[model samples]
Target chain A: MRGFPSDEELMKRCKSGDLSAFELLVLRYKDEVMNFIYHVIGDYHRAEDLCQETFIKVFENAGNYRPRERFRSWLFTIAVNLCRNELRYRARHKAASLEDLLQADPLSERFLIDRADTPDMICEKKEREEIVRRAIESLPESQRMALVLREYDSLRYDEIASALGCSVSAVKSLIHRARQNLRKVLLKAGLGEGYNAGI
Target chain B: MPGYRLKCEEVREELSAYLDGEVPIWKRGLIRWHLMRCRDCAAEAFELRMVSRALRAWGDVTAPRSVVENVMRAVRLRRRKMEEERARLIARILRIAAPVAAGVIALLWITLLPAFYLSYERGKVRPLRDELVTVRVIPQSELEQLVEGRMF
Candidate 1:
């Protein structure tokens, strides 16, 4: 694993005019970046758009990359900024309930643990997941982003702080406050054994 | 902050870090003690854990196949557009320059031909005129005397 060209190496190759290396870089980070932005913006389609734009910017501006910086953080910096822009756009346009919009996609069988569980229980679980999803969506941008990066990407506090252009303590406070907000939102929508089922 | 019975607000503050295992060992112990007895704070911790779990379970969202294709497509499209613009600009310059060059050549020919013709006609008469000047011209009287003297 150590012998393989790291992301920075690939980026350097990309800087020297290797499209294949850039493509490799894209393949490496695409899903992670997509999911990060997806959680941030709450719309998968728009997340995909922003994810493409992020890579495009990276590809075009590979020359600007400084090797001292971590590529993942640098990449997320671009991603989170784009997410912010989309969020601003959504706010102005009064978009609502991204889970509702994207919920049309059928839950794969993996979400169902046991066939023995009654369909009613399954529906109840899905309903609770949706509520949790909406509660997450309702968080303020910075808080929501911190929570997403921390939980989904599993980035360290300092790394997340780097990505978000904030201090580590600020990142911690953001996630903490975000949890408090989530608790309020979730409990208000009714949290009990069902919402906490899978966990 | 050590060796103190933890307040619920303090536990709330530490929940995210505690869930992440970022809390110090002693602080974690403090949080453990707090959650053991406090139902509200414990429930909050449980819910936050659930949230983290749900997002983690999202796994890879797996961007549609078109995303990668679209990125490369856009790159190619921009390159093509620039190539077309460069070609169009060259054509535009040629369009302007070709007529101007032809006009200059035509003007030069139209102006120089008459000058060349006049020069050629001048060359034909120049030596004749010079000869007439070099020879001494005799008036008609001198010519008649010469002819009368011939009778003598």
Candidate 2:
């Protein structure tokens, strides 16, 4: 009805009882949404569940979708809200350590190894990466969220602000502070100078 | 004015933004003037630049393929189950409403019409019964005898 129906078109059909359209929407966004959630929650299993739940909400609430907003942004809004809820729940329950967050899966190990420039480099890089990741994980929730959205997702400052419901300046400050903290951690690990040289 | 002296602490504070190229032009000039004279500030800026470079390199690190696949699979299953639930709910509501509408229509046709007809028939039968009772109470012969006595 309105300019051919991008995702909104499919979603409008979905609201009018088009099951196939809804399925198509799900197929299109599932991976992107899953990846975002995985990085946000820092746990594969939980992120998996949250990703499923996100789609379920999208499907059930399809009727509530307004054409004025980008479908992806709205969908991600639902996801970011869910992630915030999950993070809050985790905090209430007790914080999960970096060791707990790291996947012991052989696949992860293999993935790291494959990316290595050499066998010795792989081990050294892996150790450094682990330390850096831990430093990131140790960041305050807001800073971690800001860095992840910007660094991993490549979201712009405004998008990060929108996702986190903060001011643009606040997002910038968060990322800057996160980078500073990471630098400190790497410096302490004796990898800072080496990492700098390699970079 | 005395020659400007840029403190190491002040230069270090601006070094992060300098490395990011976010330093304003005026600040950049001041930082350059300071760096030209201050080795410590110069070294600090270099170190900050290196740190940024390392972080940029860290971006190359990626999650495993299997992890990605596993997450995708889980997401797919979740969506499928939700779609099924939505369909089931719509079907259930339709099922309930369809029978309710049919039952209302059948009740009007099979029960309401007959009951209305029977009520009309009772109305006619009541008037007839009153007429029959009046006739039985006063016969034609009694009426004729009253007229003949009057005449005599």
Candidate 3:
């Protein structure tokens, strides 16, 4: 029966048996969390389910919430853990779907676009994007996670270190290696000539 | 080594920090000095820079609106279910505790009621204790006297 509350206030209310407060919290974070998961897992439906599961875990454990840490960090920790579990499950099952791989193709949609650009140019860009995406996806999970936190989430290096539970130097190394791998992939995909000519 | 020629490996090591602008000033200057003279190192830097650019572009890819809404709905339902579950647990605990409390009160009443009645009955019957020989037409005084003689 009160005005809408901020996230911290909402969390307090949720702890005190306020479902509406919990729902508000869900609405606030759902999209961002989903986006994070989608990029990590490269699947919409699975990411959605994981997003739901993440909030469920958050709700179930809300009673154990300590306000000392930021709620966003806590939420991301849960989401990242879920992403790890999903990756592990896929690995153990050996069920890495080609569809999942294609979904990750940075340029897969470009192939379907009816753009008026020259086919050669479109194809070239698509190939470059695809190579970059694949290279990212193929990195060691730790490196990939660090890269994602840094590049996509716009987290500081220290923040990424905290998220990945690593040292700042380690985070730096991970991103460096990830970039190195991406560059190699891009080179193999034939962007090396023009790229080299530019510098 | 007036100007050391940068190798591909060395260039690769600095590429990440160079793109991020995280390299130390001296190291950056060194890489820059090498970039100016070493065409191979320069080319490699360019390629790596392009890769970083492409990665930044990928961040622009947005998930569909329907996907966002569906995920949110799923999250809402999950939270609602959890809330219901927590309420159920509390209700269950209360259900268990309430009857135990009531039973403890009931047990206390049952134990005390007879004891209270018996104490009241004892007070009322105390005076009658000395005069209870009417069954065989014996006088109350005679009964008391007989009992006293037997006790002495």
**lDDT of candidates 1 onward, in order:** 0.80, 0.70, 0.72
Q: Judged by TM-score, which candidate is best?
A: 1
Clashing pairs in 3: none
Whole-structure CA lDDT of model 2:
0.70
**Lowest summed-lDDT stretch of 10 residues in model 3 chain B?**
B56-65
- Give the candidate number with the greatest lDDT: 1
User: How do the residues A131-193 of candidate 2 rate in per-residue lDDT, one tens digit apiece?
Assistant: 656666678888877776666666667667777788876776777777778778768878677
Cα lDDT tens digits, model 2, B1-152, are 24666678877766655555556787778888899989877876676655555544332323334443544455467668878999999999999999999999998899789888999988988888777743456678998999899999
TM-score of 2: 0.59
Residues B22-140, candidate 1, lDDT per residue (tens digit)? 88898899899999999998987888786565444334466777888888888667657867999999999999999999999999999999999999998999888787745788999
Local accuracy of candidate 1 as per-residue lDDT tens digits, A41-135: 75667778898999998987788999999999999999988988888988899876554565544432334335787988777666655676677
Write down the TM-score of every candidate: 0.68, 0.59, 0.66
TM-score ranking, best first: 1, 3, 2
Identify the CAPRI category of the predicted complex in candidate 3: incorrect
Better of 1 and 2 by lDDT: 1
Candidate number with the higher TM-score (2 or 3): 3
